[model samples]
Target: MEELTLTTPALLFSAISLIMLAYTNRFLAYAAIIRNLSDKYLKHQDASVLRQIKNLRLRIQLTRYMQIAGISSLLFCVLTMFLIYIHYPIVAVWAFGLGLVLLILSLLFLIWEIQISAKSLQHHLGDIENHFKK
Candidate 1:
């Protein structure tokens, strides 16, 4: 087997670490929003607020799944880099490929959660419009 170049694995590991950090930040933001919504629900028990809280909970759950996937991918990327350092090209390639796939899956989940959030906002807007019409 040919000797591995440290630069290649180093760069890959850095990218993976950055992506995981972003994913974690996103999860933290969602969690904060959920907490805020819960606080609002406790202050006033409106049906619309209740619905929004439910939607937010669901979105948070989805985000949690994405966070899990992103973390898993990051782990795989680290393992791949280690393998590459040891000149195990085949296993390294497989691990890197799997990590790539997991990253893609996480992005897809993020997209879905965004769509759900948009829909929830739209529903709230419709309710506001109806209230103003009365």
Candidate 2:
């Protein structure tokens, strides 16, 4: 097998790190938005707000899971990159592939969570509309 270069692993690690950071930031922003909405509109003891809060809580939990996965993947990528540089090309390749899989899984979970949140919001809006009709 040809000797592995550090550049390939280094670039992969950098990309994974950036992706993880972006995912973490997205989770934080989502949590902030939910909190702000609850504080502003749910103060009147509205049931819909309560439902929304519950949905947000679930979404946050999923986001947390994804964030954890993303971070772990990034860490593995870095470690593998170092191994590759040290002449363990086969091991490094396996590690890099595993890291990539983890990152992809995290992204899939994030997408699912967002879809759930959107569905919950749509349901809440529908309920509000029905309230107005009566």
Candidate 3:
């Protein structure tokens, strides 16, 4: 393997930071949606509202997992850099590989969450369509 430099792991720092920021934004948006939906359901008790609540719950869970994975990747990247600093190239490579895998997993979960979010939006649009048909 090519020599592992501190710069190698450092490269992921900015990317991971950006990803974590995106994840946080998604999480905040979900939280706002859930709270608003909850208040609406309390007042109206609509079935469609219940369905939306369920869907948001699942999306929230997926977002949590994605955030967890991203955090793990960041932690591992830092560990890899520390290992490299200490002159442990072999273990550092392994840590770096694990970090990459975690990053990929986070991205996959993010994609899944986005798909669910789109479907939820479509459900809302279906309601609008039904209302217009009346």
lDDT winner among the candidates?
3
lDDT for every model? 0.78, 0.79, 0.92
Sort the candidates on lDDT, descending order: 3, 2, 1
Clash total of candidate 1: 0
- Candidate 3: which stretches are off by over 4 Å? none
TM-score of 1: 0.80
Residues 46-112, candidate 1: write the lDDT tens digits. 7866777778788878878888887778777788888887888888888877877987888888899
Rank ordering of all candidates by TM-score, starting from the highest:
3, 1, 2
Error of 3 at 88 (Å): 0.9
Could you tell me the lDDT of residue 69 within candidate 2?
A: 78
TM-score of each: 0.80, 0.78, 0.96
Higher-scoring candidate on TM-score, 2 or 3: 3
Q: Candidate 3, after superposition: displacement of residue 85 in Å?
A: 0.8
Over 63-84, each residue of candidate 3 has an lDDT whose tens digit, in order, gives 8999999999999999999999
Let me know the TM-score candidate 2 reaches against the reference structure.
0.78
Clashes of 2: 0
Off by over 4 Å in 1: 1-18
